[model samples]
Target: MDNFYLLLYLSVAMFIGSFVAGLVPLAFNMSEGRTRLLSTFGAGLLVGTALSVIVPEGVEALYIVHTEKYLPGAVQNKDRNQIISNSLIQPVASNLAAKINYPTYFGNSVVGKGVVEQMQQSPVMDKKETDEYRHSEASVNFNAINQSIGYSLVFGFLFMFLIDQISKYLSSKDGDRTHLKLTATVGLVVHAAADGVAFGSASATNRAGVQFIVFLAIMLHKAPAAFGLVSFLLVEGIERFRIRRHLIIFSVAAPVAAMVTYYLIVVVENDKSSTDSATGTLMLFSAGTFLYVATVHILPELLGSNVKDYQLVNSATEGSSRGYSESRASLKLIELISVIVGAISPIF
Candidate 1:
C-alpha cells in the first residue's frame, strides 16, 4: 500500500509540475483581463504548496541536525555520556552541554548539579565556576558541513535560474507559441528528475514516509495541470490528436520517476551509514527547486500582463470568444475538472 500510494503521489506531482495555463477555456477564451488573474491563482497554488508542505519539513530537519553540530548540545535526558572513563573529559563535556543550550535534551536540569559534576570530573573543578561557565565551553565544529550547505544554496539558485530563462526562451518561439507547451514539457521532465532525487534520497535516509507525502502532494496537483496545458496547446495550434498524446505522457511522469526512485530508495533504506539527517540536505535541494520554479518561472508568468491576449484575440474574432464559445464551454469545464481532479486526487 505504501508503494502504491507512493507511485500514485509521484505520478500526480509530475503531472502538476507541468501545468498548462492556456488550457482553462474560460481564461483562454475570456476577456484577457480574466486570464491574467487565473494564471496568478495557479501560481499561487504552486507557491502555497511549496511553503505549506516542503519548507517546514526542510526547516525542521535543518534545525535538528544543524543544532547538533552548531550548538554544544547533548541528547537531553537519559545518560547521553557513555560510560567510558577515558580521562572523563568527554562525559564531562557532554554533561556541561546538557546544562547549557539544551538542558532538557541532555537531562541535566539542576544548574549547580551540572556544574559540580563537570568540575569534579574536570580535575580542575574550581570554586570560580558559575552558571556562566558553560558559556565559554566549546564543542566540535561542523564548519565544513555548514560550508557545503552554503555551496548547495548557490548551486540550486543558479541551476533553477538557468532553467527558467531557457524555458522562457522556448516558450516564446513564434512558430510555437506552444513555447510554454514545449518548455513545460522540459519542465515536467526536470520536475520528474527532481522528484526522483527527492524520493531516492529519502529511501536512503530511511524516512520513506516523507517521500510518500511529497509524491501524494505532487499527484494532487497535476491532473488539472495536464488538462490546462492541453487547452494552452490548442492555442499553440496543437491538434486534438497531439493533445491527447501529451496528456498521456504527462500523466505517466510520476510513475516513471517513482520507479527510478524505488531502486535507490531500497538501496539506501538498507545502508547503515545513511541517516535521517541526510533528509535535511535533500529537503533543502528540493526547496531550492520549488522556490526557483514558483518565483522565477511560474509567478512571473502568472503575474505578467497577458490581458493583451484577450484584446487582440477579441479583436481578431470580432467579439467571438476564442475558446469559451457556447459550443466549447462544456468541454473546457471538463478540462478544468480534470485539472481539479489531478490536483486533489492523490489524497484518496
Candidate 2:
C-alpha cells in the first residue's frame, strides 16, 4: 500500500478515536475514579511505547544513517590500490570487477574499464598517501551525531515541562483563568502536532512492522488524551459549546500536522540520510515527551488527593477496617493489573 494512504488512514483513525473518547465522558457521565483509571492505563501505554518501541527505533535509525553515510566510503577505500593494480594487470578486469562486490564512490564504479584506463595513466598511490587516507577516515567523528540526538531528547522533555509550568502559573493568577485554559490547550495542540511529526517520520522508514507499532502506540493514547482534555475543560466550568469547539480543533491538529510533515519529508528532504536523521530525532524527542507525560503528569493525577484522602479516612475510622483493607487492596491490584496490561499491549 502507498505510504500516503496509510498515513491518511491513521489520521482519520486518530480523529475519530479522539472525538469519540472525548464524547464518551460527556455522554456516559463516567465517574472520576474510572477517568483516573483510564488515564493511568494510557500513561502506562505511553511509557511502554517510549521504552519498548520509540527509543529502540530511534537508535536503530541513527545507526542505519551512520552506516549509510560513513561505512560505504570506508569500505570503498579499503583496498583501492589493490583493485586498481589488478585492473591494470588483467585484460578481463571488468569481468573480475563484476564478480567482486566493491563499493562505488560518488556513483562511479572503481574497477570499470574506463576507471582502469584512468588508473593506468595515473601514478599509484604511495604508502604515505594510503596512510593519510586512513588517518582522515579515523578523524571523522560520528559521536557528535549521537550527542545531538541525546540533547534533542532532553530538549523535548524540557520543552513540554516548560509549557506545563507556564500554563499552571497563568491559571494560578487572579482574575478569570480561561486564557490559561487556552494556553494549556495550545500546548496540547503542539504536542499533538509533535505526534504527527513522529507519525510522518516513522512512515518514511517504509517498514511495515515499524509503521504498525508506531500507529498502534499513537492510537492507544490519542483518545484517552482527548478524553482527559475534555474532562479538564469540564472541570474548569467551560461552556459546552466552547468545549465542543475546542475538541473539534484538537482532533484536527494531529492529522493536519501529520500530512504536512509527511509531505516535507518525502518531497523536501528527499534524501535517505536526512530522512533518517529527522525521523530518529523526532522519535527520540517524542519518547522524552511521552516519558514526561506518563511519569510526571498522568501517574500523579491517577494517585492524587482522592486516594490519599480515602487512605487517611480509612485509617482514622477503624470500625470498618476489614472492608476498607479489602477495598483498598482490590483497587491497588486492579490498578497494577491495568498498568501491566497497558505496558505489554503493544507487542500484539
Candidate 3:
C-alpha cells in the first residue's frame, strides 16, 4: 500500500497504545510491581530496537546514500559496460541494463556516442567541462558526511539527557512533585514527537521491514511511557480529568510530528539523497535517545535504586513492610525476564 497510509496507521497505533497504557492505571489501580515490570519490558524493547535494528540500519542507509551521491556517474557507466561485455547471455545483460535504466547503455549507447560527438565538436569545451566536474566532485567527501552523522547521534543522546536532567531538577525543587511530574511529561511528549519523526523518516525509505521494526519499537515504549506519566500525575494528586487531557495531548503529539516530518521530507524536499541522509540521521539520533532512556532513566527506577523516593513505595510501606520487600524482589526477577524477552523479541 501507500507509505503515507502506513505511516498514518502506525501513528494511530502509537496513540492507541499510549492511551491504553495511561488509562489502565487510572481505571484500576495497578500494583507497583506490575508497573515496574511493564516499564522494564518497554526499556528492554527500546534497547533492543536501538542496538539490533536502528543503529545498524542507520549506518547502512547512510553508507548507501554516500556511495550514490558521491560516486561518479562515469564509474557507474563503466561498471555497467563491463558487466554487459562480460555476460555470457547478451539478452539477459541487456534486459538487466534496461531494468536498471543505465543511462550510458540505454538507447544505442548514449554515453559513448554522445561523448564521442561532443569531443569531436569541441575538445576545448569538453576539457573545460571535465576539469570543472572533477573540481566539483572533489567537494563531495564521505568523511565529512560520516562525521556529521556521528555528531548528530551524539547530539540526539545529549538532547534527551538534558531533558531528563531538567525534569529531575524540577522534581527535586518542587515539594509536591508537581513540577517534576509535569516536566517529565513534557520531556516525554517531546520524545514522542521525535519518535514520530523517526517513524515518518523510516516510512519515507519505502522499506517495509524498516517501517515495521521502527513502528514496533515506538509502540512498545509509548504505552509504558504514558502509563508512567499518568501514574506519576495520579500519585501527585492531580485530577483524573486533567490526567486524561494530558494523555490525550501526549498520544497525539507523536503522530502529528511524524505526519509533519514525513510530509516535509517526502513531499517538500522530494530529493532521494536528502531523504536517505535525513532518515539515517534521525534513526541514529533516535538510537541515542532510546539508549539514554532505557539504560539511565528506566533501568535504575526498575532496580529500586529510587524506590524510597517513590510515592508508591512510601504509601505501600505505610500499610505493610513484609509484602513490599517480597514483592519488590519477585518483581525484580520478573523485570529481568521481561527485559530479556523485550530485547530479543525483535530478533524473531
- Clashes per prediction? 22, 0, 0
> Model 3 — which ten-residue stretch has the worst lDDT?
312-321
Worst 10 residues of 1 by lDDT: 312-321
Global fold similarity of model 2 (TM-score): 0.75
lDDT of 3: 0.69
Give a tens-digit lDDT track for model 3, residues 1-348.
388888888888888888998899888876765666667787888888888888878887787876665443223224533433433344454455446543545456867555444433431223465466446663555667778778867987897777656655655665766555566667778778878877877777788787888788787777767776787788778999999998998899989988998898778887888878777888788788788767665664455434444432221111112233333433356668999998987677
Cα shift from native, residue 203, model 2 (Å): 2.0
Q: Write the per-residue lDDT of candidate 1 for residues 1-348, one digit (tens) a residue.
A: 465455555555555554332234423444443443343344444454445555556555555655543333332242324322323565566565556654444455576556655644543323344223334432223544565455654565566666655654555545554455666656555654664555454433334556655554444334344444555556677777777666566555555655565554454455422343555566556656655654554333333324343221111112111222223212134334433443343233
TM-score of each: 0.53, 0.75, 0.73
Candidate order (TM-score): 2, 3, 1
- The number of residue pairs in model 3 that clash at the backbone is 0
Model 2 residue 2 CA deviation (Å) reads: 0.7
- Tens-place lDDT per residue, model 2, 15-92, is 888788778757776565665566557777878877887888888888788766553223344464454554455546
Q: Per-model C-alpha lDDT, please?
A: 0.47, 0.67, 0.69
